[model samples]
Target: MLEKVRYEGAYPTREKADEAVRLVLSGLGRQLTGDERVDLAARLPWEAARGLTAQIPDTRQLTGWAFVKDLAARTNASLATTRWDTGSVFAAVAAHAGPDLLTRILHQLPTGYALLFGRAELTQAA
Candidate 1:
């Protein structure tokens, strides 16, 4: 999942990024159901996102402008400059599968550093 999800912006340190992950995990744990828990657990090692550093390529060496540009292209979303202090990236995976499909995919996403916003069809990945 981490490999498929493109990351954007300057996370000063891994700890900063991990802080976001921690917040997301706490929120998501409260949103789970019995079936969802079972399905997630069966997927493999439970804390997949925690292993993100190992699985995903590093972007730290890239220039800030280059990093954001690459991520924006990969995710098919523009990086917002006005709201730069907030969430730097604004991404949306369109409905090749429609709203229901996206909802399921999103429900599986870790919530801490990542935020879900906007309408069903045009969901924003911040």
Candidate 2:
């Protein structure tokens, strides 16, 4: 059952960002180890998530902007401008079955999980 969660524009609270990240991490199978997950999960600025997301592999394959553009068209939210960041992508699906569908995403997202997790950009925290 997919409950309707609102995409509240930009997250004004860390809780919101955290929830979104949790959802995405869960969705991505948390492919990262506990330490890696901890590092990514730690409190940081939105811009930092962008940089980190860009570093993650298979992320390049993620058509975040396009997905949001499509989602906006389907929903009342007119999110015309595609924000090319992980949080934005997470927010895109937060309203649907994201957090709940972690298992499925885990199997689907990782083309080569090592490629992403091993990257210095993703592992090197600020």
Candidate 3:
């Protein structure tokens, strides 16, 4: 996981990549619930899974912008950097989740999550 994050984020050190992975996963944990969450945790390595399972989750779900804003505040990082970290970490995660599970996860979250996971959000013309 750290390797993927490091490669995707171009982090200078393993620690930096690890931090990004943990922060992104923890934020996502707050947003994911039910069987999809459990299934994802099961799919990941134990340490990564713990990051996803550890959060208690907020009662109200946050939009993707809000999620990034919250993470930026928590890390004292700039929004651009936080957004990059989220994208890098989620790119790794989306690879792990594959198309099907990722589709389920994106469905559960609010708008903008698909792009966060490195997938486009498409709408059918009416």
Per lDDT, the best of the predicted structures is 3
The prediction achieving the highest TM-score against the true structure is 3
lDDT of 1: 0.36
TM-scores of the models, in the order given: 0.36, 0.24, 0.96
Candidate 2 lDDT over 27-119, as tens digits, reads 343233334333443433454344334434433333334444443453344464322223453433432323434333333443432222222
Least accurate stretch of 10 residues (summed lDDT) in model 3?
Answer: 115-124
Candidate 1: deviation at residue 90, Å? 12
As a TM-score, model 1 comes out at: 0.36
The runs of at least 3 residues in candidate 3 whose Cα sits more than 4 Å from the true structure, single-residue gaps closed, are 124-126
Alpha carbon lDDT of each predicted model: 0.36, 0.37, 0.91
lDDT tens string, model 3, 42-82?
88889999999999877989988899999999999999999
Relative to the true structure, candidate 2 reaches a TM of 0.24
* Residues 1-126, model 1: lDDT tens digits: 222122443556655444434333333333433454344334423453232212333323333344344444544545563123123222212212245543554564433222432333334679
Order of all candidates by lDDT, from best down to worst?
Answer: 3, 2, 1
* Whole-model lDDT, model 2: 0.37
State which candidate, 2 or 3, has the greater TM-score. Answer: 3
| Model 1: CA > 4 A from native | 1-6, 48-102, 105-126
